[model samples]
Target: LTPELKCDRPDLRGNLVIKEKAITYQAGKEAVTQLQFERAVSCFSKAITLQPDQLQTQFYVERAEVYLQLCDFNSAALDYKHACYLEPQTKTHFHRLAFIYYLQGQCLCDQGMFLDALESFAKATELKPNFKPYHMRLACLTALGRYSDCIRLVTNWLKIDPPSADLFTLRARLYHQINQAALCYYDLKAALRLNPSCADALSLLEEMKEAAECSRQQAVSKAVEGELTNALSKITTAVEKNPEKAQYYLFGIIYRRLKDFIAAIEDLVLAVELCDAVAECSEREKPDNSNSLEEDAQAQLVLTYNDFAVHCFSQGFYSEAIKLLTKAIHEQRDESGLFINRGCFLKQEEWLFALADYQQAEELDPQNRSIWFRLALIHNTMGLHSFGKNFQDAADKFSLAIKYKPGVAQYYGNRAKAHTRMHRMEEAKLDALSALILGSTNDELLRLFPGCSLSDVISSATAQTVKAQLMEQTQMWKLAGRPVTEAVRKVLHQRQSLYRTGPRLSPLRLADASEAALCAAKHPYAWRNFRGLGLNC
Candidate 1:
């Protein structure tokens, strides 16, 4: 052999380099077989660098495998991408690179890097043109409020034969965002035609059938046209089909119109639950409009509850009405009218519950005269069952009612009862007089002491009768020729105090409508039954 070694032979040098590349590739395979991942990555990478561009695809793919074994995903993804570029005709490399991009997009999305994630997802769609990448891209775009771009993407994809139902449904969802109810309806119909069992398409159809809350519009129209049966039938079918918020709401309202309160209540409850869920989901998918949607849902729920409650009350289902109004109050805690209506319902059940509700309403609107009146009634009932502090509370509540409208005879009459309960005779007499002047009868005032006996009570005798009795006794004492005793003077002062409660409303000054005012004067100590309709006044 010559010492020059024939280095100028270009073909031999090329042959040697090819042999070295082959040996390096073989060594990489051996290292991978032995599970020496670090050494395999180094060997495969060297082979990829030394191989010709046309032949480097296999080496890059092998290096990517080793990098995967080493848990170096970024390196593996780069190697797979290079393999795709080297061999554009091979689908396996393109699919692998596309999958890597999808995974990268998912990671970025989870990290809240929506824009970066979208770029990776778009690249995956460009390479694969499949469903998963499109779904990810669509979601990312929706979160970014790029609904127009999503519409374009879904619209282009929907051009395929036997068109994808899921694609149409997604486009409809985008249209819903842009308030294009007409387009949403068409797309939903197209989706249903493609695949009748598409759940999303069916629900959306229920939402946009008439382009303005479908079932509700149709149901209301049918009802107004004197087709109550047809309205109920339509709403029932819609509920069975979708059971969505609007469907349930319309169904409940139709049942309410038919006076089927039980069914109305059940459906309204379901609608409220669905509305609550939608409001929560809006917090994530539509944060910009979430608060308004939640508020609107709350208002709708409250109104529905109140409507059902009013129907329940008319049907004499007091308990059901009270429960519905209670739920309404829970949905709208600040709505004073809800509390007022609930208090009225609870009046037939228990005065304590009615009292609490009326108290809440008074707190919301201090100047609400009706609330004050209701509270007065509840407290009067409480006072009848209680004494002391409760009686005082009843009087105070009456005073509040009178403060708002001082002319109401019912308030003064109730205050008289409360005062009598607390043994404030002076105040009770004054209130009794005011009540009589304001149109309450003496019989109503007498009912204030329902089973109470006042035989020895000082107010039972008139000042004229006491004075005559004193005159007779004085004549008798003069005949006996004895000075007046201290006890007799004390009795005279007590009689003066009783007469100072002022003259009662005389029958002469009373209006002709108050003819019952004279009954108390003829029988000054008679008690009447308190169970009459006029007792509240």
Candidate 2:
């Protein structure tokens, strides 16, 4: 109007103000976008100071993102809280706050602050319901062994997202921990269909599908380990509550580990009878109660009976072991180890009965070395010293046992006994020495072969030389499969005379038979088999 000159000045002040504001806003946005989080933080702070109310929530949210990027989660959480405060009803604001809390919880988890992480994740789920974080927290709770808490969390998560593969997978894992294999498999199948690439879910499904087959076998192994820990705790409680229930089968497992085979059998037999009574009761009266607990109880009883019988046979309780084993066989006649064990025990006490049992067990499991060893021992013990046949047979079985259990010195020692019985003295000595080297210190065996005195051996070196000559002639006879010749006899005579002087078998005459040449003049054939057979030749 009146200030045309002022207008002509191009509104310099206003333009300058607009240009400064644009520059500030652009710098703040650029810093945040480029992930220069520290600079972005500063820039945003400056922008907020310059224009307090303009894009306030956006600025706060951007700065919070930058803080989170820098791993300053607590700081980012405060910024997000402020953003949410600025926009109370905005879903994005609540979601942003929840995400920040979730990230903070993850950091706490990585630091092993599990309780803190659980609280953070709980808070996140409260602010914004989600499928992933709830499952994640469920995993953390499971890891902490907080089974009840995990069940509650996963149950809530499942309600919200009934078809969520992750929640199903998590719930399946919890159910598996609680020994709910059937329920676990149901959930696992659901997860597998939803996410086939989930390795954990797939692996669990495979284990669950094989559960029936492995359950009895695994129950025995678990019962062995658990008898010392939680299994014992449960058994103790059960016994305290109901002493007449014959839960003493669990005690039998403990006694079996302690090697009290007699006690184990007694408790296990009673446990089996009690289990049978329980089964009868369940069938007749408690028809509606068809739970897995009752099934496992029955399975445990059967496994305990089998274990007891196996142990009895192993520890040489022949008659009693046979009774229990026969009972087990009548119940389930297909178990190879049961037949083998009973056969072995019977063979030890009554060979005729044992022979039929062993033959049956052999038909069932021909490749089992213990059964073979027992059979071979029986043959050898019953006057069947056919070295060509029995030795070879026993050798094969012992070799197999050695391959399976190389560290058990007794196996090697047993093979040595077989070799000794066959008149393979050097081979037997080598095996015995090997057994001793492997920690089999048998004083009885050590006393059987008197060690040579150094002086006596040296004093008889002349006689030894004559013996060496005779041995050499014998070896020549054996190798050529004939008797000693005239030339060899003459050489033996000279070697005998020379051996009386000093260790006169000179370096050249020492030949390939170093031990024979150095020791004395025994019949070279005396050591022929020892050397040719690769012993201390």
Candidate 3:
């Protein structure tokens, strides 16, 4: 129990343990013969701990072979290094050690841990200065973007080994990454001499053949500088070099800028087809919305179709414009803007189709106020055509529109017409009055009261003037005090909601001395400068 102290002198060794060490060594040799690697390693380790051979390398070599059987590479490598040290003439032991390091480097590289892989590879290269380890280390350096290190490694490799076509070509690429074009060219040329049919070298040579570059990137720069013709020329050469999906898309963009709609449409359509084909082959992974090539191409196509359709509409080709928009709608059904635009064209003579389009648009974007307003317009127009049969639907749609965007005077004006058609006089008067006060140029109201200006309506003498004017036109319709005053109060309340003590504040004050028919009012053109609402027909 003295903790088994080791004797520094060989003569001081205990006799019983010295024989046991020999026995352990013999047992290890027997375990190896029987292929029991774990037991062999255990026995050999104990033998070495008891009586390690310093002069003779047999002890390390035997344990190293057992470690190899167990695939314990690190331990096997350490044992072989000791063997190499004891017998400096045995080159195989050094090779075995380097091979173990190489295997470790390969394993780390496969796991994408490039930095660790580089360390292992560097150790392998230092042990055995050969092309294989050098090349492996170069790969790790390249992966880590240590291009300068890779160049130095390759340079060292070139000095040691005979000329290799692959090595030269690879070094050329490393030079290229660091933007050393002259050095890259020299390496590529050297590679060509070793093997004239080297494909990679030949390809790189062809890319550098174009003067000032035929890359699509160059074309993009030209396009940005507003040189469409020159940009088109560059992109044409790029397309010839590589007719990829992105190339066709760039071609489409250039054509669009040139206002050559026919060619633009063709190229974009091809881009969509090519992108879809690639997606299909790759099992159609969900694309990121912002950067998806297919989405961008299709979106551009929709816009082009919209502009072309509008142009056709202006040229009085209504049917052709409708067909174009119909194609656009088919292309991008989720686009609520497309449906609303198409409905505007159909509103001319094809009322039912317009109604269907607006309904579909509503389903796609239920919260969009433009869709709501378009629906209201279609319904009101239909009610007018059918003699007030759809006035109630028209009123409801306008209310929905107003609920989302409460300050649009056009919405209230149209709703007032619907309410008047439905014989709801109270609602009609409130809406009509609100519409005029909020700056609606209600054409029907204008036709009814031709002499009443916007200034006259908002001025202090508005009450008496409106009553006298309305009575002069239709003496039978009696003007009331309470409803007219309440309508004015509601308009002021709305004005307060929009502007706080600003130039937009309403000028009219409520003296509760009002008796005027709202139908006697005209378009409020004076306040039109406040805000303009975007309403599509």
Candidate 4:
């Protein structure tokens, strides 16, 4: 019969002489079995109308199933909800209702109606509390960035079911999204423990390790090139990819190098916390296998302490810098660089302590040029502060510097100055000549003796050659009032004329009196000539 005719004859009797609704319900089930969803829906609707007060819960459930097949989600949901109300105590009824809501949620999710889909899936989970509905709800929550909700839901579900690898992996990924990296790693490790062959968990772990290594290499390269901003960017990406101890340690180091002390401290502290967490997690593992992570973390912690001390020193916080360095030294006594760096800071305020640190560094690394150089510089500076009384000390330090780095001209020049201050004229002259031979400037020689002529200080042959070069280059007789020295004039000439390329030399490079006096007595009009030429000197 046609659907219209069947609807018009709804009052017809059944085989038991009961209401026509039972016969119509049977026909709807037959239509559903045949996959004629529209015909089944129409027949179920007519049966429900014919026996509105006496309708069985099966009528609504059957129609809901047909509506689901037809992809009419709203109708299916309404019928399933009604079936739930009619058979509230039946497990089968609620399970069927949950299935319909789950299907509706899937359709909504496909349509990009995430909030609606989330509601549907949540209701399904609430009704059934099954794995499929719970998983679907978590997917919806995750897609919506509802991390806290997803975590709570998964955590509650875990209480009901024994731990599964896939479920743990899902929760771990959710924790990762929320930046709870330690917790994420904890869950991932747990997942691995449950099922060692879980490919997805293993792949994620490997990716994090690779990303951390790549970031560390890139950061180091950029920092070495003095590209601090790019280095920070690389380390930041690394931290995002893997919020592990090594990555945080490297990030802290980069921040310290960039002189961002506050950020460096925060990252370093976090790194230590993560290290502790990792240690706690791994405590149960085999003792004979060794923990490389723990060793690396401890090393990084010491390095971070040393680097932070350097940062403090750069900002002139000497006491704090020394304290931090002391802590680092206490932790790792074999680090020679730390001793040298701490000595540098202590040298400013505590000479004795500085000496002790330098001596320690020397013992640790006898052949290190930098340690020797720093020791010599500190001694030289201290001696200079005592006027001529400390000339022997200054000279001794300069000698040590020369012994370690024999080719350095500055060391010879510094020693010559110390010898001059002590009135050891012959020794001073010899050292001065050695400095000159080693490429020390004539200006340094002139500074050592103010009133003496270049010939009085050195051989006339050397004096005359330097004098001739000065006269040709500077015309130094220009300044009428100054005492003239040929070597000084040569230095002045280079500064005032030769080194100046264009219209004028920078004010900073202007020739001073000692340099300008080499030929000042021989060419008195040179100053006027210079003025007429628009030269500032």
Candidate 5:
């Protein structure tokens, strides 16, 4: 009977069923030999159905192979799993299952199902912890961006197996992805030492070195151009690639240039930490070589703190800036610039603290006129805020300022105001006259006096008269129900000016009368009504 007919009749005859299934299995084998995978699959399915309990594990495996050839990975995996179940103790069966799982994972990877593929390959490795399957699992993990998992897997595998160049290379690549460049370099070196002919390891090592150099050069170029953000990115890459203390220092420099004081401070702190660690390690290994890195790191730390303080000041973070400056001053006690900066920040809301800082700065550099001037200004401001309550202190500060820089007229004028507030008329006059001789204005002098000159009084009176006249005219226009147009306002303004300068005549001058006549002439009826009312013409 034909293979199809035999498969269709599984119970044709109990005595002949076994022989019939054997014939069907032979037909499936022949189909497979001819590479007709679909026909082979159909025949195999029928053979298994004919005598399900009698089927050998080889039967399932052969059919699974056919399924795989057809690229039906899911079906192939199932068939291979069934083979493994059928012959649980057979090593070949488990190996075949693992191979099928590996193939399934590759298919999943091609379809961009990285997570699923990772599971599949992981299962394959679990089923057969062989070289190829383990490596495949690592590759799948890498594709999934699970570098940590890959590293852990490789590390565990290395503990179990003898170290090989290929495994070392794989672990090195995993380290590279996570920015553990030192570990990556160690692995690459181990890989090359094991197999001196490993082209990939050598190439990777060279590439890392070249990448670090290129990054350093590009960062320097960007920094020279003041492209701070771009420089930061390049330096960051360099740090990730090499992570030397010097690279960290450069990263901090870039951050400082960007005015990211907080980030800069953090990076510099990290650099110092790393440097200390290195120094400790070196001392343990060779004590004579320890001081260089520590010394350089200490210097850089002080500079970093100073730069961080400046940025904090610019951003108006006075408390933080003062803290950073204090840290710098602690490290470099004689830095007048640091003391000055801290004093400037303190002057905003902490005058006493600011005064102390300026005093320290003055002791350090007594000839700095700018420092004296700042002290004078701060004292004057403080006196103003405490006017009549702290006049002596204000006068003392102004005198100190003039003592340092005797030619400044502003110091004398400010001192004169302070004395006037204290009722020291003689001292106030002397100071005011000195300020006037040194180019202070009369207005500045008048501020100290209780009364102005007669001419000044007369000018003030004239202004008041003009202001009253304008108001009266505006009120009169509103009472008369007139719109008070621009021409009428101009005439009113001229009338006020005339009253101010000319002799008093009926409380309105001849110029005002002529202006009124002009306005009345514009409306003859209004003028006639005015005369009828017995008003002055």
Candidate 6:
């Protein structure tokens, strides 16, 4: 039929009957209510074809939802856009347009096309003027270090919703971007007033306040910028003037940075004790806790505790770090990095209990290669070579570690050990050679295998030279281009036959070789050990 004629046709019958098909489209809607998306799409498509212009937008929209269920995002977007053009007055159409753009943006973001995702998210926010996607784009811009654009967009969003806690928090983040510590603290205080339970707002407020105080103190006390003794003298003088203040922890941090571990621990302990007494006295004064103010104090204490733990770990104080990290982990179990840090400290102490912690870390985040390598190393150290086999299980991980960290000669050396144990001699030799070549000192290879000297194993020659050396070694025992001893000859013959043909044994009969060797000591006629065989133990 001609295109024009088909458009004008009104004589179709049976399933194509307009009234019945309209009923079928209505039944499709009922089917959707019954959760039959496939049948709904089928009926909707047939209805649209039958009653040309009757419910094109509605039918396409329904079908588009079905396509979305089938994970056909591109087709769903196409159908949705068509529906929008068909019925521009539908608010749902514009919402779906924005939703599709959001989906596309997320897909692009997952693919690491952040700029493309930013454009798509901008389109979505233009369509809906919503906070969710706009904030997402703002965060993405911030992460990409596009601070100017992030500042402008976030400022505009804050103006549109001046009192919103999220906007205030975001504005505080913007102030942080420009290093305006006091301004960031003020915005964060505003955010906490709006939503006292927001952990991020409380954290930002505490951090900005600390930064501002640090700046003020640094500017006043040129005496603070000195050795630990000088700083401690200054703090002592300041405390003599005002002993009840909370600035002792700041002095503790200075001592900690100066490597005065004993003094730092003493001062930090005193600061925590003072802070506790203040908190207790305040609680006695105000029996009813103010939520926002209490949250602010709690945030400060958490930061102080976390920093103390990290400082202890850095100073090889694993037990102290573990004590603090355990408390933190009890409060926040979802933080996988804490487990990783604890595992590292445990490893430094050679505590096998760290294995369980590392396993937990890997469960939470499987992509951390350091955790994987540590696990593998722990297994190898414990003589659990089978469990350590993952390092050699896939060529990709072995290759990736080699590529990024060619300097860790011990890693290559250990991989060589693994490959050698697996009977991959050529790969083992290649790894050993790479280690010897890249390692700053040849002592690393010698340190690796205290059992065997790597220099003796790896000749001062290239790979081709080593191959030639092996060939020379092989030739030393050759008798008429083959092994000299009868047993060794038979073994080699069997190996060659198995390689050249199929699995067949007994290419040569060894009926008299043993007795011949026994008689050779007395008769002077039977075969003896080959010259290079070194038969005497």
Most accurate candidate by lDDT: 5
Against the true structure, candidate 2 reaches a TM-score of: 0.34
Q: Write the per-residue lDDT of candidate 5 for residues 91-120, one digit (tens) a residue.
A: 887887777788888888888888888888
Candidate number with the higher TM-score (3 or 5): 5
lDDT of 3 at 361: 78
Q: How far is each candidate from the true structure, as Cα RMSD in Å? A: 21.7, 26.9, 22.9, 19.3, 25.3, 37.3
Regions of model 1 farther than 4 Å from truth: 1-220, 224-226, 236-251, 265-297, 345-349, 387-405, 410-429, 443-537
Best by TM-score: 5
Candidate 4 pairs with clashing backbones: 477-520, 478-527, 484-517, 485-518
Determine which window of 10 residues in candidate 1 has minimal summed lDDT. Answer: 528-537
Which residue ranges in model 4 land beyond 4 Å of their true spot?
A: 1-73, 108-116, 138-160, 171-187, 239-253, 261-322, 332-537
Report lDDT (CA) for all predictions: 0.68, 0.61, 0.70, 0.69, 0.71, 0.61
TM per candidate comes to 0.39, 0.34, 0.40, 0.48, 0.54, 0.34
Each candidate: how many clashes?
0, 12, 0, 4, 0, 0
Q: How close is candidate 1 to the true structure, as a TM-score?
A: 0.39
Q: Which sections of candidate 2 miss by over 4 Å?
A: 1-22, 33-35, 160-172, 175-537
Candidate 6 residue lDDT tens string, 283-309: 556334333333333333333445566
